[model samples]
Target: MSTTQNSGRWPHEAPPAGQDRWSWRPQLLSELPLIRRELRRSLVADTSDAAAEQEEELHERLVLLMDELLSNALRHGRAPVAGLVRRTASSWLLVVSDAAATVPPHPDPDRDPARGGLGLRMVADLTTAYGWCSDGGRKHVWAVLAPA
Candidate 1:
């Protein structure tokens, strides 16, 4: 029940999204709900049945991935945190960027999962691929999402 229209491709398949994809520069944590809503609307506007389920599933995964990345960037990394979702014929790319460049992103499976520290692990399992790198003064943690 979303009004957003996909440029021909079912939200799940995500038509060729040129050079830059959906991008966001969230100023406060309070803006996350709005951002999530917009993303969900755009990706699930016209899906149905199995495809709908798949799109919904992928959308949920991306939400969690984005949440973890953004929160981590704000809590641990530096300022100017940004997020983007890119799509091609067969895959979706979720990227989170921040000014922090010293500490690299690591998923410590052995860490306790109660309070926290398990977000990255979840990202690894939920996404088709996951990695992070630092460029200039920015660090980007990216995940590849696809149906299993």
Candidate 2:
């Protein structure tokens, strides 16, 4: 596997230090629904004092972002895929890691939406900050969303 820390055009950074973190392993695509449910539950439990609608929207965005990154790892990266959610004072960080250190995220700006590779682009646009890094033979892709 390639040892390149951050192989793509995006910046490289580790998951931010936070108040709490949750981690899980996701090896199959079929587990997405369960993952989403658990993520929502966790968000609701550890959530802030934000307005109800805003909190719901944040949960939705986090779930969708996790789905995209975790699905990509399951479909293309080598197992076992790891997922993490970290809640900091100002943001929530979502990270997914796999054994495919040689294969970093590829975001094609010119790709057609119907071709279905636009998730990462949407993620980049939606998040406050996002990037990936390879460490200890695992490639980690992470995104940070404001808690608001």
Candidate 3:
């Protein structure tokens, strides 16, 4: 079984003064493992005592959500492009950038089972909320998880 320790809230002091309170940029699939590790570390480092159990469950859910989001991006978002995942004071955002300008169709529960289109539905269920945006040449699909 996986174990986790509660680290309080994310440190507001990590970023230099006057820097964007938020961090953002494009990311690659190869960076996902490291991102997961950093997210856990950030949680542990931020929380105080008495948060271990809560953190553990939150971490578990976050991992599963991340896996689902990334998998959907790779399998359906189309194009081998970069993405962005950001953590803010209130929520964790998973952003997958792709070349497709078309918005993803809403999950159809009635579609034929053999067509294989349940990933986003799972993502929608797992996350606190999710949506997508397009700009210039890229489409960004994002989901948010409330802070633990």
Candidate 4:
């Protein structure tokens, strides 16, 4: 695969063609809370009260997106599941990586309401943008969301 242009200004050189700006492999589900806490610290913000509120809201959205993506990875992927999050000036880029190289599911409008696909559907609707790609045996499903 070739390098595609990223929509944000990240500090590192472009990822290895099909990878993200950063990555992590959570050892256990219990580590998610810690991950969230650390991610909260990585955020850039203003000092105003309004900015604080907006930052809070953005953090909440990031948490929700993280949950959905992680759950999907744990449920559908193979071992050594990983995750990634990048904080840009105007947005957050989040990704859940899995060992499975198979394609990630898209939002299916006609599927059962309570069965499957709702999570991906919610992800698609809630985020500014969403996409997935598999490089070799690693699959990365990612989303971009406004910071505020």
Candidate 5:
């Protein structure tokens, strides 16, 4: 709930106890393209020395993460009210809000892949850090990307 002011410390410091958190809400599947575009812009703006190639690579990774998050929301979040993706000065948070209260389970790396389910693990590997929380009647799954 506490406002994350410093860019470098986000995703590392837990939110302060009892503060209204800031969240972004996006609606409709069509809106995802726009969201992706905006995310790329934000990434570019936030990085001081990102090369064009590096930016392209980051953009691709962001798109993949976004796709995974969106797909997971649609498939598992159980009729999500809306999808929210938030960016702090230091981290990115992806939230898929559903009426369902259950949070996504963490991936078990040792489990046999034949059983399926690897999205969360991919997310963890791709991002700097990731976590989730459920409160105020919504569930949020999020990941943070380190500054380029």
Candidate 6:
């Protein structure tokens, strides 16, 4: 039902091959908080010099980004949603996948700002790079956050 074109490789940049990768499959929306907690722990476990305030800020940003993508998959895309974070030396690749392989992500251009449909644009602004791809009957939406 979405008008978005089926551009399998939007932006055409591939996710990096990182030194480490963490992934989770959340079947319910209520599992987000726990997932976020685990993700935060993995992200900051090695950064001993990170200030408390900076850590908190990073947590907030991670929650916002993850929530937006996962919620979209839960609401619009098919189930069995998975979240992946690949950590390289200086960057992190965040990817969310759902079974809706044929349905591409649609960024509504005409939605009212007050009504809350601009999440895709917000994701684009927050990430250094972003794109989507369809592989193995799953649609993967990804973003790269550098200076990880």
- Model 2 clash count equals 0
TM-score of 3: 0.62
Q: Over 4 Å off in model 6, which ranges?
A: 1-13, 50-56
Candidate 4 matches the true fold with a TM-score of: 0.70
**Model 6 lDDT tens row, 1-148:** 1222223224533466665467888888898888888877766764566465566665567667877888788888998899887776766677889999878777766678899977777777677777787889999888777643
lDDT value, candidate 6, whole model? 0.74
What are the runs in model 4 whose C-alpha is more than 4 Å off? Answer: 1-23, 41-50
| Top-TM-score structure, candidate number | 2
- Candidate 3, which segments miss by more than 4 Å at Cα? 1-49, 103-106, 112-116
lDDT of 5 by residue, 47-121 (tens): 577366666676678667876777667666666455555656655555556656555434666767788777766
Query: Candidate 4 clashing pairs?
Result: none
Compute each candidate's TM-score over C-alphas: 0.78, 0.86, 0.62, 0.70, 0.62, 0.81
Q: For residues 28-129, write the lDDT of model 2, one tens digit per residue.
A: 899989999998888788767665567898889989999998998998899999999888788888889999987878877778889987778888877888
Give the clashing residue pairs of candidate 1, or none. none
**Candidate 5 stretches greater than 4 Å from native:** 1-51
Q: Once superposed on the true structure, which residue ranges of model 2 sit more than 4 Å away at CA?
A: 1-8, 48-51
Q: Least accurate stretch of 10 residues (summed lDDT) in model 2?
A: 1-10
Best by lDDT: 2
| lDDT (Cα, tens digit) per residue for candidate 3, span 101-130 | 565525665667688876666666566656
In order of TM-score, best first, we have 2, 6, 1, 4, 5, 3
By TM-score, is 5 or 6 better? 6
Per-model clash counts, in order, read: 0, 0, 6, 0, 1, 0
Candidate order by decreasing lDDT: 2, 6, 1, 4, 5, 3
